[model samples]
Target: MLEDAGGHVRDADDDQMRLECGVFGAWNVAESSAITALGLHALQHRGQEACGIASFDGQLFHTERHMGHVGEAFSGTDLVHRLPGRYAIGHTRYATSGASVIRNVQPMFADLEASGIAIAHNGNLTNFRALHTQLVAEGSIFQSTSDSEVILHLVARSRKGSMEARFIDALSRIEGGYALLALTNECLIGARDPLGIRPLVLGELDDAYVLASETCALEMIGARFVRDIEHGEVVVISGKRTLRSSRPFPAARARPCLFEYVYFSRPDSVVNGRSVYDVRKRMGACLAQETGVDADVVVPVPDSGVPAALGFAQASGIPYELGIIRSHYMGRTFIQPTQGVRELGVRMKHSPNRQVLEGKRVVLIDDSIVRGTTSRKIVRMVREAGAREIHFRSASPPIKWPDFYGIDMPDRDKLLAARKTLAEMQEILEVDSLGFLSVDGLYHAMDAGPRDPVHPQFTDHYFTGEYPTRLLDREIAEGRNDPVERQLSLLVTA
Candidate 1:
């Protein structure tokens, strides 16, 4: 069973690492809201809980936020017409940092002294709680609990002369792995964090400038990929169809999240100049070389694990087969109010093919195992199909630490790898053997060389516990900061 943002038990949580939000913005384009809707459709896999679009039609800013998929909300021409404009920004959210309420849905708009600003953010802010506390103390009335709103308040309170200056001022005050798109009266703006932990790319669609979380969105809208917005860069695109770039933060080597190549990004996307699909295949090839079992057939866990399983099969000389078939007809938001119904939904989600699994030593390949509940159930289903032995493999390294950036991972104690040894996890899953891709092997797959003790290549804290940014909220929550120190730091940053 899945839990909603309100802590209420729901149906069909996949027990995988939840995706962060996706953001898209268009400047100086015809039917920009429609274009943004198309981009959101391509990025639907990133976040499904809610979607919102904000557009400026010269005189007034029109906004619409809805609960559910982008197709459900914006597929109709009538709804898209409601958001008429040549300048727009959109967001698809998964509630990584806020409750799944309508108020929390993003493209969060605020009316500033200079101009109305609509901001869509794609990552969690580490210093959010501290900033929120200080802002509230200073009389900032917040309508939403989302960390994205904090950015708007910061921009609203800035003493900067221009809208772009105010936006940069807000960015300089916040710390975390973030990719942001802002819609103002004068221009459309995009910004990446100092570490480039989240992705934001620049694209061109005729006379318009596009900013999206992934290149796949650009492809969906027939936008030409210009380049990736550099780390600590703020790009401003005015009505003249020109881009002005600036870097407001200290220079640092980029440390993009490793999970993008492993799971989060769409397979079709090219992130940081590397193909996501190719990276996953290389990861699987590396995994096969590291741990190969004598098996008759290699089977993917279906959908997410397919590319990696194919690479594993090719490298290990084992025949690849569709041992498990997933039901694509099942709606993601289908209601299952009870635990029994929810468990039944899980069973209905995936089924084993007896022809491939019966009387065979099967090697099961999955993207990663978080809590291991879903993995155990899949193993049981394969066993019921008469598999003689089940050797389970994870394409990515063990997720031993929780992510504070954006990916919605469970606490350390709840993670299967964090709590159990290999033998212990194998016993718990009732599999013949279980293996995970080593951390070094994963780095090699990305062609980034060995992991550096002083400065890592990627944001691999989930596996190595080497977080790229400060976790101010987590530290405060865990009582690791003194009250005096917390107040002093908040005063300086706030």
Candidate 2:
């Protein structure tokens, strides 16, 4: 089955990491909630668990938050009608900071002493546990267990005179990657972390200013791309249609997540001045150059693998074929709520095309391998379809470290590449051969030159264990001799 743009297929979920959320905000737009909904729809690939929109209709703030796809939650309901406004902010969440539940759904709203504010955040907070512990000890009653709720509490406790100042104060106290959008009675605010670990873009539509996680969101609402919000910068769009900008955090080298180019972002979107599709194609070409194999046909794993497979075919001068067909009607497997059904979902999601694979040497191109479970199933399916030999290629390097920055990655023990050698991985997957892109090749694809050993250009600890920000939670937990701590130590040592 074809993976839903709104959510990952159930079986694929185990093998793919999930981005935390996608955020969108607009100032001075008519029917702002509807427009924000469209923006969230375009950004559905970023998160698929829950969706919410909060809008200020000149007098009062209206909100609609529900657990489901954006279209399911907004299209068939009167939820949009209740959210009439000129300013708005929205979030589509894929639980990373908290458990997947309605209480964790965002565009988390707060009615502070100064004014009401609604925020949609995209990136995980590395110091979440520390901040949460401190805030709770200070008598702050959290509405949800989500790390995002800490920001709301911080804003409420800030002694700053203006709401904007309070917002900036709260942000400065927090650490780690964030691309957030906030809506207040007077203005819409957007900000990015100092290191730019996540993406945030600015756009304009008619008299309105738009802020979204990806350019595709802006394009969906007929907005013109206005350059990315610089790292550490804060932008405020007033109800009067005036736009102001500032830098709240000290200047730092920007290191946007490299995974955005590999798997997280939409192929149609542009992030950090590069086309994601173009970058993925380059990654495929680079992988082909590193390990070109003799094969009768180059087949994409489907959906996410299409562009890369095309590039691999172009580079290797092999015929590209759709050897596997995906079903579009299958819902996410994790939602099955039963182990047996969830396991069965893997077969329902995809089927091998015997005519294309029969007696042919096939090269399979995939974006990445997380657990090797799905890859094993795919290889077996292809083999059963009469494939004589199967070679697997990953566009990204082996992911050895876990991501704490908004990506819901498995623990170190569950990672196939983290625990297994290349030969072991090939043996486990039962493939003829397996190859992965090198870290240097990834940098070349990004056109960022070779990665600097001292200071890497991107947030890529998943491949290289050199983390960009402090992992406060992990550090605190590492002192104990627990299994998790031991695993973390092994990762560090590796």
TM-scores of all predicted structures: 0.96, 0.93
Following a full C-alpha superposition, what root-mean-square deviation does model 2 have from the true structure? 5.4
Question: Model 1, which residues run further than 4 Å from truth?
Answer: 1-14, 96-98, 337-341
- Model 2 residue pairs with clashes: 1-326, 1-327, 1-349, 1-350, 2-326, 2-327, 10-333
Q: Judge candidate 1 against the unseen true structure and give its global Cα lDDT, from 0 to 1.
A: 0.89
Q: What is the Cα-based TM-score of model 1? A: 0.96
lDDT of predicted model 2: 0.87
Which stretches in model 2 have alpha-carbon errors above 4 Å?
Answer: 1-13, 76-80, 96-98, 333-343, 480-494
lDDT of 1 at 206: 88
For model 2, where is the 10-residue window of minimal lDDT?
A: 1-10
TM-score of candidate 2 relative to the true fold: 0.93
| 1-494 per-residue lDDT for model 2 (tens digits) | 22321222333346767898999998988888899999999999889889999999888999889988999988855655789878889999886323667898998999987789998999888767777877788899988878789999888988888889999988877877899888998899999999999999999999778999999998899999999999999999995689999996669998999999999999999999999999999999999999999999999998889999999999999999999999887765336667777665567878899999999999999999998988888899899999999999999999998888788777777788999999999999999999999999999999999999887899999999888987766776675345564344323310
